[model samples]
Target: MSDVTTPKRGRPGYDQAAILEIAVLAFNEYGYDATSMGVLASRLTLSKAAIYHHFSSKEELLQLALDHALGGLEGLLLEPGAATGAAIDRLAHVLRGAVHVLADRLPYVTLLLRVRGNTDVERQALTRRRAFDRAVATLVTAARDEGSLRADIDPAVVTRLLFGMVNSIAEWYRPTGPTDAAHLANDVLAVALNGLRTPA
Candidate 1:
């Protein structure tokens, strides 16, 4: 029903980036399984053939979104600023960074958070999410080992609880809310790390 024909590699004057943006919105609005190539084509004012030329399938589009959302998050941990701090301090810095990352990648990550593990693509995304959490758990372990954290519960438990508190931010956090991401992260860290029950 569209006049657009497929260009070589589907250059429709819209590159991979534009498709990614539009596709993320579609996935968010319709869920990955419910969205089809035709739906994307309809929205883009391009042919289904054109959408396919740029992306192998709907799954591929989801993968690209995941990479963009999660990649930015993994980068903060490796930054030199995250390197020199004590474990708790580094943990705070990383949390702060995560809030910014979440804000930056809000829609992509929002769709990421909503996935129900109904498909292989969703399952793989879940695995990657767990992997990122484990990395932060390692920081909790380091803090416990260095005696900076109170010893009682396992480091893994603390990390789980910490993320439980952090992950919910997506559900309620708004870019134009009364508060900003950085302050929210500090508050989250304080409650998760400081509000814990200690032997003291």
Candidate 2:
């Protein structure tokens, strides 16, 4: 008689992207500074060593998550529509694109909105955020100069108010909610542009 042995199966492994998604969600839930690698491992049902295999440190994870969000937003400024059309239309495209990005990357964007420059990683993200804001402010200025938007308000204020409206979505928006990305973008544009547009 011969004896046969069965091989033990190894535990499932998580790739960087999957780990990043879970980590970003946790950061949004518990906050980046508060979330430790052990906490993330627990959330992922993996050992801390397993997570360490993919990410060198928690700050690395934070940087990657912030990059995901900032990349989406900054990329919008480079779109052809952003550069070609009337400043008002370009601004609309940018705002609409931003709404979609927020909806699509809600957790990431949510985490980004919560960043307060507590660390070097956060300060870098803040600097990038400020650059994006400055680009939008320029668009707002162009739109105002072209008679598309109202001139009474400073472009900086308009930029802040416009983004304040857009950024608010991170607070309460849900992917499974009643309003979808397109409709939300439309509602945002209507409320924003109608109010900002110079009256005919």
Candidate 3:
């Protein structure tokens, strides 16, 4: 037997994606401005130097987290269903996709939603978010033109209302919750496109 027993190996090292997930959770819990690299290191049980090995600075981590959230939303626009269907159907498909992205990427989406244009990274995220909103509004305009959506509401206003409903999910949605994304998407479409009052 050796004079001393071999020490057990420590936890596996974290990769960029794993670090990003932790960073998003920390940022979500303590707002990006309030979080620091030291705080993140403590949360991750790694030294500041170790974290620096992966990310140059806290801002870099913020950017990567925003990219994760924005990528999901941007990818939704490129899907075939979003581009080829009837305008109303496309609009519904996009809304459904948005809901799924929100639920699946809840922490990152929540962080993205909370950004206030205070920093360069945040401003860029906001710009991307607004662009996505505008794209959805275009679908609303198309749907209205097809007489499938209510013309009484301006497409811009409809776009805002639709997203307002969807974005509110970040406040209360949970991945482990009873409701899944598909059911939530259907509920959203029913209320948004079909309205609340029963047809007489």
Candidate 4:
């Protein structure tokens, strides 16, 4: 007598992951608020019931997508490069990892950046995002204290500026574009860590 029943399958070729991918793409293409189960079903060419078989609601899909993006970011902080290095190096590692995450999971990360906290799921994602930001800010502070970073600028402002640049990549970066993630990360670091003003 096994209490665990086997999970039911949805329509062939449309597992939960596949459905989630399409749903997140829709959420990014249209506004999440405007993307309903009906809209997702129409996009998937499946009945609403089939969609429900995969997800309980649009919000569930959203929560999963947000987690997908946030998880990538949060994991970066725990990496060896991020954890056991000089703060400046750690910061660089995290930023580079972010670019890779964005390149690998573009739609999910895009949706994460666009979240407005309209729902509980959105709010939770925003909270996790803020925590990530704070971690970066702390690293900035450490690097500054070590005299590796400019101290004149506030660390919080530096964090904002650094991430502002990193986040902007989502707007223009294309996987098919000339710049790959490693080169883009290098360019970002060169500009951000070094500076436009030539040394005297």
For TM-score, the strongest prediction is 3
Clashing pairs in 4: none
Would you estimate the TM-scores of all the predictions? 0.82, 0.90, 0.91, 0.91
Off-target runs (Cα >4 Å) in candidate 3 are 1-11
Across residues 50-92, which tens digit of lDDT does each residue of candidate 3 receive?
9999889999888877887888899899999998979998998
Worst 10-residue stretch by lDDT in candidate 4? Answer: 1-10
Worst 10 residues of 1 by lDDT: 1-10
Compose the digit string of candidate 2's lDDT tens values, residues 73-156: 988998999989999999999999999989987887898898999999999999999999999999999999999988897999
Model 1: colliding residue pairs: none
Candidate 3: which pairs clash?
Answer: none
Q: lDDT values of the candidates?
A: 0.79, 0.87, 0.86, 0.86
TM-score of 3: 0.91
Q: Pick by lDDT: which candidate is best?
A: 2
List the RMSD of every prediction in angstroms: 6.6, 9.2, 8.2, 5.3
- TM-score of predicted model 4? 0.91
lDDT of 4 by residue, 43-162 (tens): 989999998887888888888888888988898998999998799999889988988988877888899999988889899899999999999999999999999998798999888988
* Ranking of all candidate structures by their TM-score, best first: 3, 4, 2, 1
Candidate 4, residue 135: CA error in Å? 0.2
Better of 1 and 4 by lDDT: 4
Question: On a 0 to 1 TM-score scale, where does candidate 2 land against the true structure?
Answer: 0.90
